[model samples]
Target: EINEIIRHLNNSAPGSDNLSSFFFKDTIDYVASIITHLTNESSRTGQFPDILKEGKIIQLPEISNAINFSELRPITILTVLEKILEEFVYKQLIDYLDEKNSH
Candidate 1:
Protein backbone atom coordinates (compact mmCIF):
# COMPACT_ATOMS: atom_id res chain seq x y z
CA GLU A 1 0.00 0.00 0.00
CA ILE A 2 2.79 2.40 0.84
CA ASN A 3 4.58 1.19 -2.26
CA GLU A 4 1.54 2.00 -4.34
CA ILE A 5 1.39 5.47 -2.86
CA ILE A 6 5.04 6.05 -3.61
CA ARG A 7 4.60 4.73 -7.13
CA HIS A 8 1.68 7.02 -7.77
CA LEU A 9 3.46 10.00 -6.29
CA ASN A 10 6.52 9.35 -8.37
CA ASN A 11 4.47 8.90 -11.51
CA SER A 12 2.49 12.03 -10.86
CA ALA A 13 5.47 14.16 -10.02
CA PRO A 14 7.73 12.62 -12.71
CA GLY A 15 10.82 14.23 -11.17
CA SER A 16 12.83 13.96 -8.00
CA ASP A 17 13.57 17.67 -8.12
CA ASN A 18 10.10 18.56 -6.92
CA LEU A 19 9.00 19.13 -3.31
CA SER A 20 5.90 16.98 -3.76
CA SER A 21 8.07 13.89 -3.59
CA PHE A 22 9.25 14.88 -0.15
CA PHE A 23 5.69 15.57 0.97
CA PHE A 24 4.54 12.18 -0.30
CA LYS A 25 7.42 10.41 1.42
CA ASP A 26 6.72 12.26 4.67
CA THR A 27 3.03 11.41 4.46
CA ILE A 28 3.84 7.73 3.98
CA ASP A 29 6.23 7.82 6.91
CA TYR A 30 3.63 9.53 9.09
CA VAL A 31 1.04 6.90 8.18
CA ALA A 32 3.48 4.10 8.96
CA SER A 33 4.30 5.64 12.34
CA ILE A 34 0.63 6.00 13.26
CA ILE A 35 0.00 2.36 12.35
CA THR A 36 2.92 1.22 14.46
CA HIS A 37 1.84 3.28 17.46
CA LEU A 38 -1.75 2.08 17.27
CA THR A 39 -0.68 -1.53 16.90
CA ASN A 40 1.63 -1.37 19.89
CA GLU A 41 -0.97 0.32 22.04
CA SER A 42 -3.70 -2.13 21.10
CA SER A 43 -1.42 -5.11 21.69
CA ARG A 44 -0.49 -3.96 25.17
CA THR A 45 -4.13 -3.22 26.08
CA GLY A 46 -5.70 -6.29 24.34
CA GLN A 47 -7.98 -4.19 22.16
CA PHE A 48 -8.63 -0.80 20.57
CA PRO A 49 -10.94 0.39 23.29
CA ASP A 50 -10.40 4.05 22.58
CA ILE A 51 -11.72 3.36 19.13
CA LEU A 52 -14.54 1.14 20.35
CA LYS A 53 -15.88 1.41 23.86
CA GLU A 54 -18.93 -0.58 25.02
CA GLY A 55 -19.35 -1.85 21.45
CA LYS A 56 -19.84 1.72 20.26
CA ILE A 57 -17.60 3.37 17.72
CA ILE A 58 -15.87 6.36 19.20
CA GLN A 59 -15.89 9.47 17.11
CA LEU A 60 -12.42 10.95 16.94
CA PRO A 61 -13.12 14.42 15.73
CA GLU A 62 -9.47 15.42 15.90
CA ILE A 63 -8.44 12.71 13.50
CA SER A 64 -11.44 13.24 11.26
CA ASN A 65 -10.79 16.96 11.07
CA ALA A 66 -7.09 16.50 10.41
CA ILE A 67 -7.85 14.45 7.33
CA ASN A 68 -9.00 16.94 4.74
CA PHE A 69 -10.76 15.07 1.96
CA SER A 70 -10.56 18.10 -0.29
CA GLU A 71 -6.78 18.06 -0.15
CA LEU A 72 -6.49 14.30 -0.47
CA ARG A 73 -6.40 14.13 -4.24
CA PRO A 74 -3.64 11.53 -4.43
CA ILE A 75 -4.51 9.63 -1.29
CA THR A 76 -6.68 6.53 -1.63
CA ILE A 77 -8.90 4.85 0.95
CA LEU A 78 -6.81 1.68 0.56
CA THR A 79 -4.02 3.34 2.46
CA VAL A 80 -6.23 3.54 5.55
CA LEU A 81 -7.40 -0.05 5.05
CA GLU A 82 -3.85 -1.33 4.76
CA LYS A 83 -2.85 0.43 7.96
CA ILE A 84 -5.87 -1.15 9.71
CA LEU A 85 -4.86 -4.62 8.48
CA GLU A 86 -1.34 -4.06 9.73
CA GLU A 87 -2.62 -3.08 13.15
CA PHE A 88 -4.87 -6.16 13.31
CA VAL A 89 -2.03 -8.49 12.38
CA TYR A 90 0.23 -6.92 14.94
CA LYS A 91 -2.36 -7.33 17.66
CA GLN A 92 -2.96 -10.97 16.74
CA LEU A 93 0.75 -11.73 16.76
CA ILE A 94 1.12 -10.13 20.16
CA ASP A 95 -1.81 -12.11 21.54
CA TYR A 96 -0.31 -15.34 20.24
CA LEU A 97 2.99 -14.49 21.84
CA ASP A 98 1.37 -13.73 25.17
CA GLU A 99 -0.55 -17.00 25.13
CA LYS A 100 2.56 -18.97 24.31
CA ASN A 101 4.48 -17.23 27.07
CA SER A 102 1.75 -18.06 29.58
CA HIS A 103 1.80 -21.71 28.62
Candidate 2:
Protein backbone atom coordinates (compact mmCIF):
# COMPACT_ATOMS: atom_id res chain seq x y z
CA GLU A 1 0.00 0.00 0.00
CA ILE A 2 2.79 2.41 0.89
CA ASN A 3 4.60 1.71 -2.35
CA GLU A 4 1.43 2.09 -4.34
CA ILE A 5 0.62 5.40 -2.67
CA ILE A 6 4.11 6.81 -2.95
CA ARG A 7 4.30 6.01 -6.63
CA HIS A 8 1.48 8.44 -7.41
CA LEU A 9 2.61 11.34 -5.26
CA ASN A 10 3.77 14.58 -6.83
CA ASN A 11 7.06 16.25 -6.00
CA SER A 12 5.58 18.93 -3.84
CA ALA A 13 7.22 21.05 -1.15
CA PRO A 14 8.05 19.44 2.14
CA GLY A 15 6.41 20.23 5.43
CA SER A 16 8.02 21.01 8.78
CA ASP A 17 9.87 17.67 8.67
CA ASN A 18 11.73 18.83 5.57
CA LEU A 19 11.13 15.44 3.96
CA SER A 20 10.12 15.52 0.33
CA SER A 21 8.25 13.08 -1.90
CA PHE A 22 11.50 12.23 -3.66
CA PHE A 23 13.03 11.32 -0.35
CA PHE A 24 10.25 8.79 0.36
CA LYS A 25 10.34 7.30 -3.14
CA ASP A 26 14.11 6.99 -3.01
CA THR A 27 14.24 5.45 0.44
CA ILE A 28 11.01 3.45 0.36
CA ASP A 29 12.76 0.12 0.20
CA TYR A 30 14.61 1.01 3.39
CA VAL A 31 11.86 2.93 5.16
CA ALA A 32 8.56 1.45 4.06
CA SER A 33 8.21 -0.76 7.13
CA ILE A 34 8.94 2.03 9.55
CA ILE A 35 6.45 4.35 7.86
CA THR A 36 3.85 1.62 7.68
CA HIS A 37 4.26 0.95 11.36
CA LEU A 38 3.87 4.58 12.26
CA THR A 39 0.82 4.91 10.10
CA ASN A 40 -0.77 1.81 11.53
CA GLU A 41 0.00 2.84 15.06
CA SER A 42 -1.58 6.19 14.40
CA SER A 43 -4.69 4.53 13.06
CA ARG A 44 -4.93 2.06 15.94
CA THR A 45 -4.41 4.69 18.57
CA GLY A 46 -6.74 7.22 16.93
CA GLN A 47 -4.04 9.84 17.46
CA PHE A 48 -1.32 11.04 15.17
CA PRO A 49 2.13 12.18 16.21
CA ASP A 50 2.40 15.90 16.66
CA ILE A 51 4.78 16.21 13.77
CA LEU A 52 2.40 14.49 11.41
CA LYS A 53 -0.22 17.12 12.15
CA GLU A 54 2.15 20.01 11.68
CA GLY A 55 2.16 21.86 8.39
CA LYS A 56 3.66 24.96 6.86
CA ILE A 57 1.07 27.33 5.53
CA ILE A 58 2.17 29.53 2.69
CA GLN A 59 0.14 32.09 0.82
CA LEU A 60 0.45 32.07 -2.94
CA PRO A 61 -0.79 34.98 -4.95
CA GLU A 62 -3.41 34.24 -7.58
CA ILE A 63 -1.93 36.90 -9.86
CA SER A 64 1.57 38.24 -10.35
CA ASN A 65 0.67 41.41 -8.54
CA ALA A 66 -1.57 40.56 -5.60
CA ILE A 67 -2.90 43.33 -3.38
CA ASN A 68 -5.91 41.91 -1.57
CA PHE A 69 -6.34 38.99 0.83
CA SER A 70 -8.79 37.33 -1.52
CA GLU A 71 -6.12 37.22 -4.20
CA LEU A 72 -3.90 35.02 -2.05
CA ARG A 73 -4.58 31.33 -1.57
CA PRO A 74 -3.42 29.60 1.55
CA ILE A 75 -1.75 26.28 0.96
CA THR A 76 -0.73 23.91 3.71
CA ILE A 77 2.24 21.67 3.11
CA LEU A 78 2.07 18.49 5.20
CA THR A 79 4.74 15.86 5.74
CA VAL A 80 5.15 12.77 3.61
CA LEU A 81 4.08 10.66 6.55
CA GLU A 82 0.90 12.65 6.84
CA LYS A 83 0.29 12.27 3.15
CA ILE A 84 0.72 8.51 3.30
CA LEU A 85 -1.54 8.17 6.31
CA GLU A 86 -4.12 10.27 4.54
CA GLU A 87 -4.01 8.08 1.46
CA PHE A 88 -4.47 4.99 3.58
CA VAL A 89 -7.58 6.36 5.27
CA TYR A 90 -8.90 7.76 2.00
CA LYS A 91 -8.57 4.44 0.21
CA GLN A 92 -10.28 2.68 3.09
CA LEU A 93 -13.15 5.14 3.05
CA ILE A 94 -13.59 4.81 -0.70
CA ASP A 95 -13.58 1.05 -0.48
CA TYR A 96 -16.14 1.07 2.30
CA LEU A 97 -18.40 3.35 0.33
CA ASP A 98 -18.05 1.21 -2.76
CA GLU A 99 -18.90 -1.93 -0.85
CA LYS A 100 -21.89 -0.30 0.77
CA ASN A 101 -23.20 0.95 -2.51
CA SER A 102 -22.78 -2.45 -4.12
CA HIS A 103 -25.16 -4.14 -1.69
Candidate 3:
Protein backbone atom coordinates (compact mmCIF):
# COMPACT_ATOMS: atom_id res chain seq x y z
CA GLU A 1 0.00 0.00 0.00
CA ILE A 2 2.83 2.39 0.88
CA ASN A 3 4.56 1.55 -2.38
CA GLU A 4 1.37 2.09 -4.33
CA ILE A 5 0.85 5.46 -2.68
CA ILE A 6 4.44 6.49 -3.34
CA ARG A 7 4.16 5.34 -6.95
CA HIS A 8 1.15 7.55 -7.48
CA LEU A 9 2.52 10.67 -5.83
CA ASN A 10 3.33 13.57 -8.13
CA ASN A 11 6.94 14.51 -8.66
CA SER A 12 6.50 17.86 -7.04
CA ALA A 13 8.72 20.08 -4.98
CA PRO A 14 9.61 18.80 -1.54
CA GLY A 15 8.71 20.25 1.84
CA SER A 16 11.00 21.36 4.67
CA ASP A 17 13.00 18.16 4.38
CA ASN A 18 13.80 18.88 0.73
CA LEU A 19 13.09 15.28 -0.28
CA SER A 20 10.65 15.11 -3.15
CA SER A 21 8.08 12.45 -3.93
CA PHE A 22 10.24 11.24 -6.81
CA PHE A 23 12.95 10.40 -4.33
CA PHE A 24 10.60 8.19 -2.36
CA LYS A 25 9.33 6.51 -5.48
CA ASP A 26 12.86 5.74 -6.59
CA THR A 27 13.86 4.35 -3.19
CA ILE A 28 10.66 2.59 -2.19
CA ASP A 29 12.27 -0.84 -2.58
CA TYR A 30 14.88 -0.01 0.05
CA VAL A 31 12.67 2.11 2.31
CA ALA A 32 9.38 0.22 2.25
CA SER A 33 10.05 -1.82 5.39
CA ILE A 34 11.22 1.17 7.39
CA ILE A 35 8.24 3.26 6.33
CA THR A 36 5.82 0.46 7.09
CA HIS A 37 7.34 0.02 10.56
CA LEU A 38 7.17 3.74 11.21
CA THR A 39 3.56 3.88 10.14
CA ASN A 40 2.61 0.91 12.24
CA GLU A 41 4.39 2.24 15.31
CA SER A 42 2.75 5.62 14.90
CA SER A 43 -0.67 4.00 14.62
CA ARG A 44 -0.12 1.75 17.63
CA THR A 45 1.08 4.62 19.81
CA GLY A 46 -1.48 7.12 18.40
CA GLN A 47 1.33 9.63 18.07
CA PHE A 48 2.89 11.18 15.00
CA PRO A 49 6.40 12.56 14.89
CA ASP A 50 6.67 16.35 14.85
CA ILE A 51 9.35 16.25 12.17
CA LEU A 52 7.03 14.63 9.64
CA LYS A 53 4.41 17.30 10.20
CA GLU A 54 6.65 20.08 9.03
CA GLY A 55 5.70 21.75 5.75
CA LYS A 56 7.03 24.45 3.46
CA ILE A 57 4.57 27.15 2.48
CA ILE A 58 5.05 29.04 -0.72
CA GLN A 59 2.80 31.68 -2.27
CA LEU A 60 2.10 31.49 -5.98
CA PRO A 61 0.15 33.96 -8.04
CA GLU A 62 -3.33 32.89 -9.05
CA ILE A 63 -3.04 34.89 -12.22
CA SER A 64 -0.05 35.45 -14.43
CA ASN A 65 -0.19 39.20 -13.91
CA ALA A 66 -0.93 39.16 -10.21
CA ILE A 67 -0.42 42.39 -8.32
CA ASN A 68 -1.44 41.86 -4.69
CA PHE A 69 -1.40 39.32 -1.91
CA SER A 70 -5.07 38.50 -2.45
CA GLU A 71 -4.20 37.18 -5.90
CA LEU A 72 -1.76 34.73 -4.44
CA ARG A 73 -2.49 31.23 -3.21
CA PRO A 74 -0.57 29.61 -0.41
CA ILE A 75 0.63 26.13 -1.32
CA THR A 76 1.86 24.00 1.54
CA ILE A 77 4.33 21.39 0.34
CA LEU A 78 4.55 18.38 2.65
CA THR A 79 6.94 15.46 2.63
CA VAL A 80 6.00 12.22 0.88
CA LEU A 81 6.38 10.43 4.21
CA GLU A 82 3.88 12.78 5.78
CA LYS A 83 1.51 12.19 2.89
CA ILE A 84 1.89 8.43 3.27
CA LEU A 85 1.12 8.70 6.97
CA GLU A 86 -1.94 10.80 6.17
CA GLU A 87 -3.17 8.14 3.72
CA PHE A 88 -2.85 5.48 6.40
CA VAL A 89 -4.82 7.57 8.88
CA TYR A 90 -7.43 8.39 6.26
CA LYS A 91 -7.96 4.74 5.41
CA GLN A 92 -8.35 3.87 9.08
CA LEU A 93 -10.85 6.69 9.59
CA ILE A 94 -12.86 5.62 6.57
CA ASP A 95 -12.85 2.02 7.70
CA TYR A 96 -14.05 3.05 11.17
CA LEU A 97 -16.81 5.17 9.70
CA ASP A 98 -17.89 2.37 7.42
CA GLU A 99 -18.02 -0.09 10.29
CA LYS A 100 -20.04 2.35 12.39
CA ASN A 101 -22.51 2.85 9.55
CA SER A 102 -22.82 -0.89 8.93
CA HIS A 103 -23.88 -1.42 12.53
What candidate 1 gets wrong by more than 4 Å, as runs, is 1-26, 50-83, 86-103
lDDT, residue 23, model 1? 56
Model 2: how far is 9 from its true place, Å?
A: 1.4
- Across 36-83, the per-residue lDDT of candidate 2 in tens digits comes to 887788778988787677888999999989999999999998887788
Lowest-lDDT window of 10 residues in candidate 1? Answer: 51-60
What are the per-model C-alpha RMSD values against the true structure? Answer: 13.2, 1.4, 1.5
Question: What is the alpha-carbon lDDT for the whole of candidate 2?
Answer: 0.86
lDDT of 1 by residue, 1-103 (tens): 3344343443232222233444545577566566557557876887764323212122333444446545333422223333344546766679889999999
- Candidate 1 residue pairs in clash (backbone atoms < 3 Å): none
Local accuracy by lDDT, each model: 0.48, 0.86, 0.85
Give TM-scores for every candidate, taking all chains together and pairing residue i with residue i.
Answer: 0.31, 0.89, 0.86
Q: Which sequence of candidate numbers ranks them by TM-score, best first?
A: 2, 3, 1
**Candidate whose lDDT is highest:** 2
Ten residues in a row with the worst lDDT in model 2? 46-55
User: How much does candidate 1 score in TM-score?
Assistant: 0.31
lDDT of 3 at 41: 94
